[model samples]
Target: MRTAYSVETVRAAERALMARLPEGALMQRAAAGLAAACADLLGRVYGSRVVLLVGSGDNGGDALYAGARLARRGAGVTAVLLAPGRAHASGLDALRRAGGRVTGADDAEGPIARADLVMDGIVGIGGKGGLRPDAERLAGLADRSRAAVVAVDLPSGVEADTGEVRGAAVRADLTVTFGTYKPGLLVDPAREYAGIVRLVDIGLELPGEAELEALQHADVAQLLPSPAAESDKYRRGVVGIAAGSARYPGAAVLAVSGALRGGAGAVRYVGPAGDAVIARFPETLVSDAGPAGAGRVQAWVVGPGAGDDAATVAEVLAADVPVLLDADGLRLAERDAVRGRTAPTLMTPHAGEAAALLGVRREEVEGARLAAARELAAAYRATVLLKGSTTLVADDGGGAVRVNATGTPWLATAGSGDVLSGLAGSLLAAGLAARDAGSAAAHLHGLAGRFAADGAPAGAHDVAALIPEAWRDVYH
Candidate 1:
C-alpha cells in the first residue's frame, strides 16, 4: 500500500530525527538527495544552465546547497534570491565558494530565460496561499521557459494538507519530496501540478496510522476472495443485481458483465431488462421477481438504471442483505430506509449525485472531495464511494480513506459506474468489509478502464469485458 501522512505528522517526525543529529546534518542529507535527483534529470551536470528560485526558508537552503553541488561539477548555476537579505548565510557562502553567483530578483530574468532547468524553492509545505509577486513573476517565467521545472518538497502554492491549489502554483515536471509522501502529493488538484514524485528517505521515523492509503498489487492480491474445494455456489456468495430498466436495457448487460467477473459464484439479476441481461450473460439467473421476492442473495446492487422505480429501490433497501446503491437508485431510494438498515450499506455517487445529497453544488463536492466524501459517509451512516478522477472510499467508522491509484481519464464514459457498483456489491457478498469492497472494486475497475481504452475511446461494455484481465493482473 502507498501510504500518506499529514503535514503535522511529517513535522513531528522531522523534529524527532533532527534532535538526534547535528545542526546541519538533516539539511545536508536532503540536499544530497535533491542534487542527485537533479543530476539524473539534467543527465549531464557539466555546463548545464541551472537556475534556483531561492526563497527565505529551509526550502531555499536546500536549493542553494544543491546548486553549489552542481556548480562544483561545472554547471552554470545562478540563485535568484527572492529574499536576499534573509537568505541562508551558510548556504550562500557554500554556493559562492563553489563558484555559484547570487542574483537579485530583478536580475533573475537573464539566467531564468536560457536555463536548462528551474528549481523551485520559493515555498514549501509550511507556506500557504498564492505566491508573492516576485515568486509569482518567476513562476510565470518558469511556465514559459523551455527548462524542465522541478519542485523541492511539493509544488509551491498548493495546500500540503488538503491538496487544494489556490491561485497561481508552479506546475513541476518532477517533485523530490523528503521523508514521506504528503497528502497533497497523492490527492488531486495539487496532484496534477506534481507531474512525477520521487521520495528521498531522510531517516525520519513516523509512527501511528496514515491518513490515506492507495492499495498496490500485493496489497490487493491478499484481499481477493477465493473459494475452497468444499464451497458450493451459495457458500461462495450470490450477488443479486437490481439494475437496468426498459428504457436502458444496456445497464443490465453491463452490470451483470461486471458481477459475473467479480468473484461471486452466481449473479441473480432482478430487473425489468431480464431478456437483455440473459442475452448478454447467460450465467445470470434472470428474474422479474422484485428484490424482496428474489431468492437468497448475500448482497444486492440496486439503482443502476432504475429510472422512476422508487418502490423497487425501497424494497431492496429494506432487505437484510448488504446493499449497494448507484445512479438513479441513489436519487430514488429513501434515505431513512438506507440509514436504518441492519446490514451494511454502500452508496456510490459521482460529484453531481454527491452534491444533491449534501445540498451543495457539484463544484463544491469536486473542489473538496475528501471533505465531501467524509461528510457523505457521516451523514448517510454508511460507507460512501465518491467516484471521479481519484476514487475514494470513505467509511462511516472514520478511518484512513482508501484512495484508488489505478484510474485513467479515459474511464469517464457513460454506464461505467454501473459496472463498478455491481462489482463492489459482489465483493460485499463475498464477505469483504464495506471499505475493502469499495476500494478493491475501484482498483480493478480503474485498471480495466485503462485496458479497455488503450489509447482511443471505449464504451462501458469494453471496460466490463476487461475486468478479468484486471483481476488476473492484480493477483499475478
Candidate 2:
C-alpha cells in the first residue's frame, strides 16, 4: 500500500524528527535528494543551465541548497527569489559560495527560458487556494519554457490535503516529494497538475493511519478469494445481481459478465432482462421472483440500468447482507433506507450521480473529489466509491481514504461502470469489507480495462472478459 499524510500529521512528524537530528541535517538530506533528481533529469550537471524559483519558505531553502550542489558540480545555476529579503540566509550564502548567481523574479524569464531545468519551490504543502499573482506569472513562464519543470514537495497552488486546485497552479513535468506522498499527489484535479511523482525518504516516522492509501498489485493479491479443498459453489459465495430492465437489457448482461469473472462461485441474477442475461451467460442462476426470492446470496448488487424500480431497490436494501448500489439504484434508493441499514452498503457514483446525491453541481464534486467522497459517505452512513480519473473509496467511519488510478480513459465507454458494479459486488459476496471490496475491484477493473483496450477503444464486455487476465496478473 502507498500511503499519504495530511500537512498537519506530516508537520508533527517532521518536528519530532528534526528535534532528534542535528541542526540543518534534515534540510541537507532533502537538498541532496532534490539535487540528485535534478542531475538525473539533466543527464549531465556540468554546463547545464538551471533556474530555481525560490520563495521565503523552507521549500526555497531546499531549492537554494540544491542549486548550490548543482553549482559545485559545474552547472550554471541561478536562484530567482520571489521574496529576496526573506530567503533562507545560510542557503543563499551556500549558493553564492558555490558560484551560483542570484536574480529577482522580474529578471527570471530569460534564464528560465534558456534553462535545462526549472525547479519550483514557490509554495509548500501548507500553502493553499492557488498562487499569488507574481507567483502565477512565474508558474506560467515555467509552463511555456523548454525547461523540464520539477516541483519540490508538490506542485504549487494545489491543496495537499484535499486534492483541490482552486486557481492557477504549477504544472510540473515531475514532482520530488519528501518523506511520503501527499493526498494531492495521488488524487485527481491536483493529480493532473503533478505529472509524475518521486518520493524521497527524509526519515519522518508517520502514524499508523494515513490520510489516504493506494493499493498496489501485491496488496490487492492478498485480498483476493481462493477456494479451499472443501469449497463448493455455495461455499465459495454467490452474488445476487438485481439489474436491467425492458429498455436496457445489456446492463444485466454486462453486470452478470463481470460477476462471473469476479471470483464468485456463482451468480444469481433477478430482473426483466433474464432472457438477455441467460443468452449471454447461461451459467447464471436466473430468478424472476426479484431480490426476495433470488435464493440465498452472500451479497446483492442492485441497480445498473434498473430504470425506475424503487421497489426492487428498497427490497434489496432491506436484505440482511452486504449491498452495492450503482447506476439507477443510486438514484432510486431512499437515502434513509440506505442510512438505516445494519449491513454494509457500498455506494459507487461517478461525479454526476455524486453531485445529484449531494445536491451540488457536477463540477463541484469533480473539483473536490476527496471532500465529496467523504461527505457522501458520512451523509449516507455507507462506504462511497467515487469513480473518476482517480477512484476513491471512503468508509463512513473514516480513517484513510483509498485512492486508485489503475484505469484508462478507455474505461469511459458505455456499460463500463455497470461492469465495475458487478465486480465490486462479487467481492462483497466473497466477504471483503466494503472499503476493501471497492478498492480491490477498482484496481482489477482498471487493469482489465487496460488489458482490453491495449491502447485502443474496447467495449464493456471486453473489459469484463479481461478480469480473469487482470486477476491472474495480480495473483502471480
Candidate 3:
C-alpha cells in the first residue's frame, strides 16, 4: 500500500528524527538526495546552469544546500532570494562558500529564464495558501521556460492535507518530497500539478496507518477472494440483485452483467424485469417474488433504476444480508432504516447524490472531494463510494480511505454505476469487508472499463463483456 501522512504527523516525525541526529543532519540527507536527483536530470552536473527560487523557510534551505553541492561540482548555480533576510542563514553561507552567486529576485529574472534547470523552493508543508506576489511571478516565469522544474517538497500552494489547490500553484516537472508522501501528491487537482513524484527517506519513522492510500496490484490481489479446492456452488456465496423497471430493464441487464462476471458462485436476481435479465444472461436465476424471497443470499444489491417502487425497496431491505445501495435506492432510503441495519451497508453515490446527502452544493463536493466522501460516510454510518474523475472510497470507522486512479473519462455513460454497484455487492457476498469490497470492486471495474474501450467509446455491454479479461489480468 502507498500511504500518505498528514502535515502535522510528518512534522512530528521530522522532529523526532531531528532530535536523535546532529543539527542539520536531516536537511543534509534531504539535500543530498535532491542533488543526486537533479544530477540525473541534467545528465552532467558540470557546465549546467541551475537556478533556485529561494523562499523564507526550511524548503529554501534544502534548495540552497543542494545548489552548493552542484556548484562545487562545476555547475553554474545561482540562488534568487525572494525574502533575503528571512532565508536560511546557514544554507546561504554554505552556498557562498561553495562559489554559488546569491542575488535578490529583482535582478534574477534573466538568469531564471535562461537556466537549464529550476528548483521551486517557494513553499513547503508550512505554507497556508497560494503563492505570494513575488513567488507567483517566479512561478509564471518558470511556466514559460523550457527548463525542467523540480519542486523541493510539494508543489507550492497545494493543500497538503486535503489535496485541494487554493489558488495558483507551481506545476513541477518533478516533485522530490522528503520522508513520506503527502495526501495532495496522490489525489487529483493538486496531483495533476505534480508531475512524477519521487520520495527520499530522510530517516523518519512513519505511522503504521495512513489517513489515505492508493492501492497497488499486490494489495488488490491479496484482498480478492479465490475459491477453495473443495468448494461447491452453494458453499462459495450467492449475490441477490434488485434492480430495473419496465421503462429501464437495461439497468437490470447491466446489474446482472456485473454480478455474473464478479467472483461469486451464483447470482439470484429479483425484480419486475426478470424476463429481460433472463434474455440477456440465461445463466442467472430470476424470480418475480422480489429480493426478500430470493432465498439464501450472502449479499444484496438494491437500487439502480429501481424507480419509485416503495414496496420493492422494502422487500430488498428486509433481507438479513450485506447490502449495497445506489441510484434511486439512494434517494428513497430512510436514514433511520440504513442506520439500524444489522449487516454492513455500502452506499455508492456520484457528486449529485452526495451533495443531497450532505446538504451542500455539488460544486462544494467537487472542490473538496476527500472531505465530502468522509463526511458522507460519517453521516450515514456506512462505507461511502464517491464516484467521479477520481473515485474515493471512505470507511465510517476512520480507517484509511482509498482513491482509484485507473478510470478513464469515457466511463461517464449510462448504466456504468449500476455495474459498479453489482460488482461491489458480489464482493461483499464473497466475504470481503465492506470497505475492501467497495474499493476492490472499483479497481476491477475501472480496469475492465478501460480494457473494453482501450482507444474508443464503448457502451455498457462492452464494459460488462471485458470483466473476465480484467479478472484474469489481476490473477496473472
The predictions' CA RMSDs to the true structure, in order, are 1.3, 0.8, 2.0
Q: Which 10 consecutive positions of candidate 2 have the poorest summed lDDT? A: 255-264
TM-score per prediction, in order, is 0.97, 0.99, 0.94
Mind giving the per-residue lDDT tens digits that candidate 1 earns over 208-236?
98888889989888888999999988998
In candidate 3, stretches whose alpha carbon ends up further than 4 angstroms from where it belongs are: none
Error of 3 at 277 (Å): 1.8
Off by over 4 Å in 1: none
Q: Quantify how close model 2 is to the true structure by its C-alpha RMSD in Å.
A: 0.8
Best by TM-score: 2
- Which structure is stronger by lDDT: 2 or 3? 2
| Model 3 clashing residue pairs (backbone) | none
lDDT of 1 at 203: 96
Candidate with more favorable, higher TM-score: 1 or 2: 2
Off by over 4 Å in 2: none
* Alpha-carbon lDDT of model 1: 0.90
Q: Which pairs of residues collide in model 2?
A: none
Q: What TM-score number comes out for model 3? A: 0.94
Model 3 per-residue lDDT tens digits across residues 131-180: 88888889989888988999998999888888888888899999999998
